[model samples]
Target: MAKRSIYARELVNLMAGHWVARAVYAAARLGVADLLEAGPQHVEVLAKKANAHEGALYRLLRALASVGVFTETEPNTFSMTPKAELLCSDHPNSLRPLVLLWNELEYSAWDDIVHSIKTGECAFEYRTGSPFFDVLEKDMESARIFREAMAGASRLIPLAISEVYDFSGCNTIVDVGGSHGNLVSTILSTHPDLKGVIFDLPNVVESVKNKMGDEASRCEFAGGDFFESVPGGGDLYILSRIIHDWDDEHSIKILKNCRNAMGSDGKLLLVEIIIDTNNESSFGNWLDLHMLVMQGGSERTEAEYRRLLDAAGFELTRIIPTGQWQNIIEAVPASI
Candidate 1:
């Protein structure tokens, strides 16, 4: 009975998990970690700096400290923990943008999860009367934050991909829907001989100009919609986190357009979370729900990927697992 009661308590905690997530989000939004970057400070000091109520700020920090996000070295004085450091915007691996992005915008979408479940539609769109991308486009600050969040999250993905995939054989690589050319720059950095292109919407390409630093000489930028057409002249075409934003029909449309542009020997690579079918709890499963609720997209299983590839006249050649719930799915033109 005691064990069962403990399990029941665990269930209740799990059910109320949003409280913890929101707390973390709140800390990130408040820039509490940023304020503590210099050293330990009293909650009153932090509250003044942040323009927040002292008592409420004190409670928030105390609660967060209990969760290992911050440390209360002395009464009412809080300092950053390693986890909290990651919330500092200047930190190399800072997740501040992601945290802020989620808390500020995506947080509200979760409120409409019930609507999504009922209609199999986008909760974000349902709530705001505009699609997620449209909203991001209209809000410059949000778009910048969203881009920073994506870039911060992608810091390791390019290295993981470069290590796993052999880009030496390919002379040119094109990243479809590659925002700001971060991934492309990473690849170009590793392979000196490989030239690359960052292809996306016109505005996105324009904003990313010369942002690739030293790799700018080797990397080019192209602007267009993937649904209509993609640039050619690359031996390897990479679609990282592009396909999953769409349904099967739209995904197929994009893939087919890529196929039209790809040469006979060119290979297509999709970077995504290849969901597990064993029903074991995983981050990908939760992310799949995020997709459903937020964008009307989905994270797919390997079998589903195979079908999608086959439908687009491509053959699924391999799946390379990257550590962070992502996989590099390699495909080739079926006829080739």
Candidate 2:
């Protein structure tokens, strides 16, 4: 009975887990890890550099150190740990942008999760009185941060996709909605003979032109809406994290567009989280809630994916699990 009581208490603590998330967000926002990049610093020194209250900074550092984000060398001095290093923007696999994105704006949207549950609408739009992307479009800083957050969160998944998936024997691989062209760049680097196309909106393709650099030489930047049409003649089309943002009807439209664009022997790859059955502990389950709150989309099961692909005039061939958060759902045109 005592152990049962302890377990129940632990569950309650987990329910309030966002407190620590907000604390870490505050640390990332203030660039605490970056400040410690030079060396260990006293809390007062960090507070001065970050323009925060010294005592409050010390308290924050103490709590974070308890969680292994940093190490307290002395009464007020703190040093970065490997975990804290991830919050530094200079780190190669830094999650700084994602942490920053989870700050006040995300919190405000999440606070209205109840409203989303009640109305089957976006909690963000309900709270902010506008769509999340519309607000992002108006605010350049917010838009930049959101993009960086997405890229940062995609860190290992692109490399994992490039490495695990066989891209051989394909003339052209079209990355639909390939923002920043990271995945295609990784793929092109591995498959030398494969020409790649980054297909997205005009502004999206333009924004990442300079970012593509040498990859731009071997890749074509085609600007258009995937729902309307995609560039033709590509044997393989990669739709990474694109379909989950929409409802079933809209998802079908985008998939149908891919089907229309793909030739008889062409393939369509969807990279998304595949929710498992009766698994309350799966990350995808919680992410499904996040999706429900942020938009009306939800993480899908393998069967659900098959139904969607069939409805979009495609046949689901296989589902490959990647080393990252996503699973690759491969399909071909039904006629094939």
Best by lDDT: 1
RMSD of each: 1.4, 1.7
Off by over 4 Å in 1: none
Error of 2 at 206 (Å): 1.3
Query: Where does model 2 exceed 4 Å of error?
Result: none
Candidate 2 yields a Cα-based lDDT of 0.86
Q: Which lDDT value does model 2 have at 248?
A: 88
- Per-residue lDDT for 90-151 in model 1, tens only? 98778999888877888889998999888889898898999887787678788778888888
Model 2, C-alpha of 173: deviation from truth (Å): 1.0
Error of 1 at 32 (Å): 0.9
- Candidate 1 — worst ten consecutive residues by lDDT sum? 203-212
TM-score of 2: 0.95
